[model samples]
Target chain A: MLPDPQAGGQTGSLEHIALLRPLSAEQRAAVARQCRWRRFASDEQIIDHWADTQDVAFIVEGRVRVLSHSAGGREISFTDIDAGELVGEMSALDGRPRSASVVALGEGALLAFLPARPFRDLVSGHPELGLAVMLRLCDKLRGATDRIMDLSTLGANNRVHAELLRLARRGRRQGAAAIIAPIPVHSDIAARVSTTRETVARVMSDLTRDGLLQRRADALVVCDLQELERLVAEVRGAP
Target chain B: MLPDPQAGGQTGSLEHIALLRPLSAEQRAAVARQCRWRRFASDEQIIDHWADTQDVAFIVEGRVRVLSHSAGGREISFTDIDAGELVGEMSALDGRPRSASVVALGEGALLAFLPARPFRDLVSGHPELGLAVMLRLCDKLRGATDRIMDLSTLGANNRVHAELLRLARRGRRQGAAAIIAPIPVHSDIAARVSTTRETVARVMSDLTRDGLLQRRADALVVCDLQELERLVAEVRGAP
Candidate 1:
């Protein structure tokens, strides 16, 4: 395995692989060599469902949406991945058809890696690397399970608020109110919350009117994080 | 690695790991030696959430429930695994915290395989085994993704019918009108479909009275599979 020389030695490191923590210097070097940086424009299909290709990606920068569509045109966005998060691990580990479609939400860079036959041989030959990959997949599964539980129990309003809070935390800047850029369209919010766009629109309008959030030039400014968290608590039926 | 003594060297052979297809003699022998059989009684917790253990299990007999709960006591049963299917592959592959809980529905037998280190080493050492496991995981993930989509888009009635059909296909015995034994309690169904137990009970009673199914002494029996499928289609809003 050779590291992409063009990456200028700034490609994503093993630390980005959060599930496989505490890597030694040698192990980090080995993994870093296998990673190649690739960039995608906004709205580009980073991973296509039903494609036969076997590339797995870890987001180095930007956001990617995990989406599914029904026969009747109903779309559901199960989750999103941002900087330092992993995607395509399921297809990479399982070698099956991609379960859903993934698209870049904006310009983004990813560390693309493929552990084909040679990689497998490497894993078998190097138990530590194989263990790291396995652990990483486990972390992905754990996160997915939590998302499933949340979707099952929480209502759409709560789901929206939780997602907003998550995005705010991810993109927060020091000493500045959290500003979520490229305010997601109502349809996108509908897909994520598993509700109709009309419903999402109504809720967003209500929130805007109530001074909880403000529509900005290119983003949605969450004026009060505490208020959002309180709404989440209320949705969870907390006192 | 040693083959099970009781199985007379047939253990882990192509015949044993039938869910994994097209295995070579060498590959079969390798898998056989690495396999271990175990048993659990009804309601036994086969896997606990967040436990530090690593073993992938294939159900040789009986049933198992896959479930998760929220901090506030909400429970959801994603699905149940019956004989011939594998469980714990996600945890086994990643070696992270267990995402959910698995409990035996009845007395069950399983062929448990060790920490992914050995099997993955085996796979990396042997491409055939690695490919076989990948394909199996792919199939499972596909099914899981489809179920998630159904839960997000379909109504409660459709969810129940689809689950019943799934159970019938997997649990049916020869010429017995498809007995779905040990019917899932109403609350379980409610959680699975994101509805209330009262709603689920009312729907079940309606279906029973409509002659599509029969509430048997020991199990729920689908009298006509076609009618049940039609009911599911109708509930899904099919024209």
Candidate 2:
């Protein structure tokens, strides 16, 4: 049997990422040759926040988690990065220290890296790429702002509810229910919303009893996304 | 007094903002003709989130706040934008609806607008300008991430302490204290930290009794920035 074409076999070609669309075929080919690509196994550390990275990387295949550790030994995962998206560009672009470490979420995940100098030239030589990068960064900034809004505005249970709604979109549908495959453990939700695992469990328990939330084998099923959002908003003022 | 060169007077020339350094004099003059500038009074609404702005704006003088209203009518002020910075670019760059409204906090706030088409040309014409914009966006992204970390990792009082440390640097310093002139009101601090006014007031009272924070004639004085940092770190379980 032929091996799956992309099963972590190579770095994702530049053409696969929309951000590099402005580059001519020759430019993309040249960039491909200059870049370094590697496959990572599940749970492998990708980059350390303490040390600076000289090259920027893109996720070519599979998912990885961005996270940090607090002085108290508490770990918080920021967000999951998917294929076709750029990673580790923040430090190289702004000359700031890396803010988080990354680890692969699955085996056969691919990553591609380009040295800083060449990457700069690529953007400068192709101004379209610059606009693309700015658009991408703006989206990240907006997403971060939304999370901050949630953290500052929502209470513990409402935050859990909000997170569940976000997760629901990733799952399969079953008769009006959205099943988030491979359910996130309570601790994961707690870290995302800055609350306690026990509090999350309690909220989930109550929601389950009320039939607003459900659990399937290895997945969480959100039955009513709209209702959940309404409930969250109502909680913001219910006092 | 020479018409107060910047205050409610003239739109700033492009040369004054650091980001435009890459533009040639001719280019700056041409771009200047394509853009618009005006001043706003205190508490004046500048843009609506419901609409998309075709032109991006720059703050030439005074301060403004970026904020949004929750469905329940609770207003969350994301951050204050100071003079000599860009605003409303995110929506124009990404073609997304404006995410928040901006309002001037003081009279004589000068704002400049450059149409989308010329703005695009300006960046694409000069890749260095693209690099500059990316650097600026990267800085904003980092600041947002820091706020997210603080929200997710710190409790109410520790968040308060962290914020004070941030504001203290803006004021005059005595032996070991930095006096933040025109102290941010309790509600403002609450809005920034995602807590409530009562919570901030209670925390301030505790800190005052402990002699770690003080109020001096419409100003908030932070005593010992190092101690403030230490306290915040200790809350994270540092010895």
Candidate 3:
């Protein structure tokens, strides 16, 4: 499901957007006037895979997950975008069908949409924005590469460990460990690493049994971050 | 093994490069004068995973395979870049280590190299080049997304079939059959699909037995493209 192109919110300023930050206030205001804005509630669909519309959207508030469904109704999550980030540029730049669907996470999201032509013009007109776009794409490409390596070379258990390691790295660091507050949902992890929820549960239990993980109310603490890294490194091998 | 950045090739022009194609002749000449050129023999390494250099290289002739090795020395092929494509931009644009190793394929390769600064300047100064780079990255991202879906959902046999279908689509069509000249190397396909060579061999044999594929002295002919597509679609579910 996708929100209607013209139905949701009104246009907003581009002042807070990371990609447009390098532009001057006057420039930002000029660009913002040409865009439309919308608000979506939690679990709302923002864009559908293969949908024909090709407007680029900036996530001005809230987080969104990018994903697609296989013919079997299995969902494969790609990557999530936070506020100040953007999506739909793939279709905007290449004039191809949407690569994946996008859905709002947590609270509802506020997004500013720029039609493909204007989006292209803005990027081309601003070198800073152009470089920013390239850098963002590079970051995504690298993340995708690592995921490919994991899927191609690692097993389900190892993938779950790797995903946990990734989550831990992004979590808040404690004295000698990392605390992932509000532990991630098992099914979500399963979707990300392409495994079953049961497998994720099994791996979590194993890690707990080995004293590498500790589960507490509202948080999953890595009791020994180094040990967890070592486990992942052993499977990934030398790189 | 990675080639020394300063050890290979001399400087060359930006003329005939796809990313630079939109530039005028003068612009191409001006940009070309700032680049270095080199020739890599078959099987020669162009760049290594985690390499430190950040110069962007353009393939002027021949093809190269992008891949990485696991700790156990297993090779995972990412994608192949034919003439007119570029590589090393991940590092060049992001100022990070190379994400994967690249090696020349077939007879050899002729490439033009542009130092990171000039490459960035050329792209940022020219909107067309910037858009071209974006489009190229979009293509890579889309391809990687497809591979991710395949790796996450498809089994080895189906992955092999999907890989074949991909190759067949790129191959010569002969009425009802698609002929892939010189046939692909099973091991290479195995590397691409994250499966064992033995498994690829077994799948190929099964496909031949089922009369879906025909092996010849110089090519592998897919008997029915639609049937192969149907087989892949059946496993991928309804997308």
Candidate 4:
């Protein structure tokens, strides 16, 4: 596919994908030849949970969220995969059905689909690529474990504080503060941390009132990251 | 290490370990030469949380529980790894400190320790072995995701029900029934599903009174597996 100048110059090239960066130019070219390209509009369903598809998607542009819905119709958002990252490899490796649904986020997104067989072969044939995939899974497992610990041990307020700290770290840093522009929606944070929207709102207001958080035009600032971290660690123990 | 015929004939051979089973016999033997063996008494610590060591442990005999304690001194047991499985690989792969403490569960436990460097070399050098480990990690990530969904959507009572369904499936089968012999401790179940001992006790009693669960001389029998599954699925929706 030709590079889309309008779509931030996304060429669907294997070179830009984090999982394939270690490959030589020729190796990457071979992999790119095996991959098919697709573009998704914002909020479009890129991969449905239990769809039985085994193709792995490498994000070439924009972000996608991995999420699932409860029987009660509540959505549980797992995590976001950004450009240069890949998704759908678990099923590719294990020959299992899709474990969760993935949806493109914001504006438009570009993805390269590599069918399961070729993906597995590529990983097995390349030592560095295999290790890279292993490292990515390691990071995902660690993130999941941390969420489990928080869900098992912490209260709602503390969980909210943890989520804010996480978002702040991903946001812009000021002089001794971190600003989360267009601050994350309360309900979204609630879904991630397994809390209620009201609880998240209450926690946010309390933090703002206590001067631990600040609300500016289009941004929410974490005034004291260390204090917020201490509040979580108090109950979370030494980890 | 010699075959401890008394210790269930565990020879600490790589042949018996699931992760390395995909490797060639010669490859396994070569990898075995680089491993060291260790044994731990019941309730003894195997890997302490935050420890800097990075040796991956393959469980050859007995079982161990991976756990951590909250600042309140409440223990949160993550999962139990049985013989033929492995643990401590996260730190081995990422060079990070141990994520959680692992404790031996029975009279004695035998483990084969492969240092971080050799373990990484073993995985990256062997394609089949690497794929096997990736599959194992995929299972773990799916499990963690399921736990996250349950925690985020289900309440304490429902969580307990879900946990019981999980245990029942792992228990011994008796025709259409399932028997969890010596039934899990209420407090331990409490830690696992993030509930209180009282809540677990109350739920058990409720299930027993309703005839959905029965207490036998040495086991907790799920009288109707389908019904128990239904109860959980009522809130859990579909898999």
Candidate 5:
């Protein structure tokens, strides 16, 4: 059975989390005790569109897609949330309904925490925590703004290349070759890049032929960072 | 002569403005004291791109265009700020150099306020004030995101029509006919919609010929909003 939600023990350490680094042991304990781990199968709905849920979750494992739908049920993707990123934060902060839906891309685990009132009270007691969360929100906003600009201004090929570069950077660390194993499906790439699946497939084929990337089992591995960066720069009109 | 930046006294009232209604008298006075009124000639630069100014300004009169430049110095416009709209709030929040340049479309007047530290301090002291600003920011983010989706997903003509409907809503109130005068130049619309000028012009002409809009001296007067909304629904695949 799952542990009691009201248990007062040190639930887990929060120090290892990048955003929670400044919290004290006691505060970390408070946060960990409040958090509940939940699992979802592939394609499970973690949050429904327009639902009012004050709980904020951190992805502990696997991936999820954030998306919106039209009245006629056409889907438009916003972003993909990877492990270690916070989800449903803006809704929790503003007490608003979810603006988009979140669905697990595969079997995933999330550390969900609820009742923003307690969280706000904790932040009030600890101003540093509030500031840290605000800074994280600002960083997310900056990224969303850049993605909007990219989608609006860049062409399909450049957008795909940039997305590959970003995924590589996120999947690998400094001095280690970035690996984006088991290439994302063409339709998934199209959704993220706001292009058609055929266009994405064409671009991928071209990139493979140019020797900038290699095809793995259901994945495309980026083999040449220099070439990818060069293509991006050329598209962006960089020197 | 311009008023002294440090001089504190009575100033113009912003209570009549729709967007400023949430602000209290004390808050208005606090903001007004830090404000300096500036006048600009036609085609003058109101805010330079990449400048380090941290002041947020309000347009008391006339109009301003927010535009960005690529690394190669190619300019793309985002939107226009008309009378009574807040300008430059994003820069104030981010503390970064201006993301885009603002230019006066005609002779105009703006109330520039200084020392964002004090304004932010005021917000921190008054959570309600901060909430109001946050709501406005959220609204702007939603609009920008929607525009990005439109540019990527909609055809050129559909984008032009959607833009017209957006402008009509902003320029008109409920139960009132929208008398949108001085429609933006076709070239400007092209930039904002992320399409070619010729395409924008062709679409606008077609819209006028279809009786959806009537061309005026300086604007395109929207005649039938219901029809335009229907077109938008059809294009966006709504029920």
Candidate 6:
């Protein structure tokens, strides 16, 4: 069962997000009037696979992760969302049952929930609004395509290294090293790289022993990004 | 290397394709003026991954299959599209290079190509055109999500059954059996199900021996879809 969204505290406004920032004040106000602001605690589902109804959720604060769970309670994650990103629009656009569940990732998250009908009215009438959604969808499609390619073609070790390199690009950089905060658990890494937890543990241990990776209390640090990149590219015939 | 698009015949007119059907005759004329008609032979790539530029392609006739290839000659197919579908819009939407290559599936295919700028101009300015594209994009997103789920969660046997059920939905139906024409090769099945050619051949032989499937000269027939569905569902924890 999913936890209920707990609402409180300051949140990012519609005027500030990347997609909505392009809208004029008047347009922003119009959208704001129709949207319902809600907050959810970490690990709480914003959308569930079994749910028939869905709203377009725009992330206002914190992060959200999209994933699907197996019957055994194991999950496979697809993507993560930060503030200024949107969630649940795939179901809103296609009118299908939510194919996956989205959960609040850290601490808690704030979202502006726009019901489908009004959301469609706004997007169809405003070219910028529609383009904003399309642009984001395109990004998701490209990411999905890359994931499919990597999962199908690469060996498990290469996949893990490749995924780490990808996460490093999005993570915080300190000097020459990249840090992924709250170092993902074995299962999370397993899910992302499409390997088992044992395999991930083995690969991670090897990397740590080789000094290519270092796990601090709360983060996984890549000591040398170049070496990590080289590891990921080796199987693809890269020199 | 990719084969060139072959040109000839009376293709589906721009006005007849689903996306352009709602355009006014004048609007259609404007679009038609900017559109180019082309056809591609079987296995010919409509859009190559190496290309830097892209145009929105509307399928007027025949089918196109989308897939990504690794440097070592392995590939993973994502989806197949038929007439009334559009392709290459992802690159147009995000201004990225084509991430996947699309190839004509059957004998040949006809398409109406609209260069990126003009296509965007029409879609952004016109709600119907924009919505049409959005709907298609949404469909692709959902399909991608499903593929991700199946690839990540299901075992090889379950994945094979799941893929067959999916193909059966799109293939021709006769009595109790679902027929997939031009019966996909073992390698193709392996690619789709994320297994090896030997594994797919082994699974096929088993299914045929069990009387749940039959092999025709140019098609694979599922003789017992219920049993196949049962097989797929049991692993998925379906009731």
> What DockQ does predicted model 2 obtain?
0.55
Question: Which is the leading candidate under DockQ?
Answer: 4
Which sequence of candidate numbers ranks them by lDDT, best first?
Answer: 3, 4, 6, 2, 5, 1
**Proportion of the native interface contacts kept in model 4:** 0.81
- Weakest 10 consecutive residues of candidate 1 chain A by summed lDDT: A1-10
Off by over 4 Å in 5: A1-39, A50-63, A70-75, A82-85, A91-97, A111-137, A171-178, A216-221, B1-41, B51-63, B70-75, B82-98, B111-122, B173-177, B217-219
Decoy 5 TM-score against native: 0.77
lDDT of 1 at B106: 60
Report the lDDT tens digits of candidate 1 across residue range B100-159. Answer: 788888655445555656655655554455545555554545565666677777867777
Better of 3 and 6 by DockQ: 3
Candidate 6 off by > 4 Å: A1-13, A172-176, A217-219, A236-239, B1-12, B172-175, B217-219
Task: Give the residue spans of candidate 1 off by over 4 A.
Answer: A1-66, A79-144, A175-177, A205-212, A223-239, B1-41, B50-63, B82-86, B108-123, B171-188, B234-239
Worst 10 residues of 5 chain A by lDDT: A1-10
User: Distance (Å) between predicted and true CA of A212, model 2?
Assistant: 2.1
Candidate 6 lDDT, tens digit per residue, A1-239? 12223434323357656777777888787786677778788888888778887688888788998888775777788878898888888677767788788899878887888888887887888898798888888888888877777776787888888878887877898887899877878888888877789988998899999998999988999988878877777765432
Write down the DockQ of candidate 4.
0.79
- For candidate 5, give the DockQ: 0.29
What's the residue-level lDDT of A210 in candidate 4? 96
Alpha-carbon error at B195 in model 3, in Å?
0.9
Q: Weakest 10 consecutive residues, lDDT, candidate 4 chain A?
A: A3-12
Model 3 Cα RMSD, 1 decimal: 3.5
Where does model 4 exceed 4 Å of error?
A1-11, B1-12, B24-26
* Tens-digit lDDT string for candidate 3 (B1-239): 22323475345555557887888988777766676777899999999776689999888788999999877788999999988788988788889988899999998887777889988988899888898888888889888898999999889999999999999999999998999987899999999998889999999999999999999999999999999999998997745
Give the interface-residue alpha carbon RMSD of model 5.
3.8
lDDT of 2 by residue, A63-178 (tens): 88888766666777788888777788877676678878888886646777887788778777888788888888888888888787777777777888888888886777777778
lDDT of 4 by residue, A1-239 (tens): 54753465333477889888878998888877787778889999999896889999989889999989989777778899898899999998988988899999998688888899999998999888898899999999989988988888888889899899899888888777899988789988987887778999999999999999998889999998778778877877885
Task: Work out the TM-score per prediction.
Answer: 0.66, 0.88, 0.94, 0.94, 0.77, 0.89
Give the fraction of native contacts in model 6: 0.62
Model 2, residue pairs in steric clash: none
Q: Taking the tens digit of each residue's C-alpha lDDT, what string does model 6 give over B1-239?
A: 11223323322356666877778887776776677778778899888877787788888778998887676877777777888778888887778889788899877787778898988888898887788788888787777777777776777777877878877777888887889887877877777766778878887888899998899888989997777877887777633
lDDT of 2 at A30: 83
Give the Cα RMSD of candidate 1.
7.8
